[model samples]
Target: MKKLIPISIAILFIAVIILFVMQCNVSKECAAPAGKAETPAIRADGTDLTIAYINTDTLLLNYQLSRDLNEELLKKQEDARTNLNQEARAFESEMQEFQRKLENNGFLSRDRAEREQQRLINREQELKDLNAKLSNELMVRQQEISSQLLDSITIYLKEMNLDKDYDLILSTTVGGTILHAKDGLNITGEVLDALNNRYKKKK
Candidate 1:
C-alpha cells in the first residue's frame, strides 16, 4: 500500500507539470506568434508618451517682440547718454576756463585758486552723482520692460497650451538646458508656430 501511494503522488506531479506546459502553449498561441509581439509604448509605470525640446532658437522665435522692444529702449538710452555726455563736456570746458582765469599769467592767488578748486570739485561730484542716478533709473526701466514682456510670454504659453495637447514641452537652445532626448522629442518648431500665430492675431 505504501508503494502504491508513492506512485500515485509521482503521477499527480507529472500531470501538473504537463498541464502547466499546455497552458503556457495556449497563452503563447493567444499572444503574438513567436518574435512578433507588439512592444508597449510605456513601461509598467505608464509614462513615456510624448516629450519635446526647445532651444535658443525657440525662445528667440517665441519672443521676437522683445527684440523690437529692446531696440527702442536702447535708442532711448543712447540718446540720453549722448545728451548727458554733451552736458558733461560743457561743464568740463567751463571748469577749464575758470581754472585758466584763476591762474592768470601762470601765477594763481592762493585764496582765489582754493575757491576755484572747491567749485570744480563740487561740479565734478555733481556730475558723478548725475551719471549714477541716470544709470540706475535706466536700469530700473529696462527691468520693468523686461518683466512686462515676460508676462506677455507667459500669456502666450497659456494660449499655446490650450491649442496643443503636448505631454511634455522642453527646450534645448543655447539658453535652455536639456540633458537627454530621443528622436521627435523637439517641440521647438511647434512652439515657434504657436508664437507666430499669436503674433498674427495681435496684428
Candidate 2:
C-alpha cells in the first residue's frame, strides 16, 4: 500500500505539470480583435458610417441585384467615362496647339494666351464637374438599390434569429463600431444566396 501510494502521488504530480505547461503555452483568447482592428469606417465627407458586418454573400448578392436593376445607370456611367476620355483628348490637343504656336514664334499675344488658357481651364472644370455629377448620381442610385435589398435582408435576418436559436448576434457598424470581424461568423455567403434568390424571383 505504501509503495502504491508513492507511485500514484508521483503520477498525479507529473499530470499536473503537463497541464500547467499546456495552459502556459496558450493564453486566453480575446473576445474581439485587438489593435488596428478597432478602427471605424468613415465617409469622404467625414460622416461616421456603420456597416453591420456581413458575409461575402451579402455583398455579392447586393452587387448582383444592383447590377440587374441599374443596367441603364451602368450604361450611362460608362458613357460618361467615354465622354471624359474624349474631353481629355480635346484638352490635350488644344494645349499642344497653343504650345506649337508659341514655339513657331507666332507668340500668342498675352491677351490671346490668357483667353485660350481661360477657355481650357473652363473646359477642364466643366469636365470635372460633369464627372463628379455622374459619379454622385451612380453612387446615389447604388445606395438606393442597397437600401431596398438590405430592407428585405434585415427582415430575413430577424426571422433567422428567431428560428436559429442563437443566444445573440453581434456585428460592428460601418465605422463607428466594429472595425474588423473574424471569419466563420461572417454570414455574407448565406446572405448573398438569399439576396440572389430574392432577385431571382423579382426577375
Candidate 3:
C-alpha cells in the first residue's frame, strides 16, 4: 500500500501564509487616515495592489525539495516493507517446520509440544510489535520531512517578497476556496523555478 503525508499539514501551511497576508492587509488598512475612504482596487503606492497566488498542488508536484523528500520517504517505506517481509517469511518457515514436527510426532511429550506452541505464539507477537514500531517510525520520519519542506517554502516566500514588495500572496488548492482567478495572478511556475534553483544551490 502507498502511504501519503496528511493533507491537513499542507492546508495548515497555506493557512499560515494566508494569516500572515491577512495581518499585512489589516496593517495596510489601519495605516490609512482614519477619516479617509477606502479605494476599490489600488494601493497608496499607485500599484494595482500587487497580488499573486500559488497553486499548492502544482507547487508540490514541481518543487525539487518536495520531490526529493517524497522519494526519500518512499525509499524508507520500501525498506521497511522489505525488512518486515523477510522477517515474516522466516517466521512462516519456522511455523511450517514446527507443524511438520507435530505431524511426525517429533516432540518427546505433550509438554514439549506445548512449549513449542508457546514459542510460536511469542514469535507472532514479536512480529506484530516490530511491524507497529516500523510503521510508527516511518510516520514520524514523514512528518519531520514535511515540516522541513514547509519551513523551506515559507522562508523562500519571505526572501522573494523582500524586494518584490507583494501586497498579498495567496495559496490555492484544487477544490479550494479560490474558485476563479486570472491567469496572470498564478505564480506557481515562478515559485517552482525559484524552489528548484534554491534546492540545486543547496545540493
Using TM-score as the measure, which candidate wins? 3
Candidate 3 global TM-score: 0.79
Q: Write the per-residue lDDT of candidate 1 for residues 33-147, one digit (tens) a residue.
A: 3453342232223333334455534455345565556666676667667767876888879787876876574435778667777877888787777777666666666666656
Residue 41, model 1, lDDT = 31
- Reference-based lDDT, residue 100, model 1: 80
* Candidate 3 lDDT over residue span 1-203, tens digit each: 22333332232343333323522353465133344465534554444567778878778877777877777777777788888888889999999999999999999999999999999999999888888888887778767876786788878888888877677778877877678989988888988899899899989
The candidate maximizing lDDT is 3
For each candidate, the alpha-carbon lDDT, in order, equals 0.52, 0.50, 0.73
TM-score of 1: 0.63
Candidate structures ordered by TM-score, highest first = 3, 1, 2
Q: What is the per-residue lDDT of model 2 for residues 67-95, given as tens digits with 9 covering 90 to 100?
A: 45556456656676677678778878988
Least lDDT summed over 10 consecutive residues: which range in candidate 2? 16-25
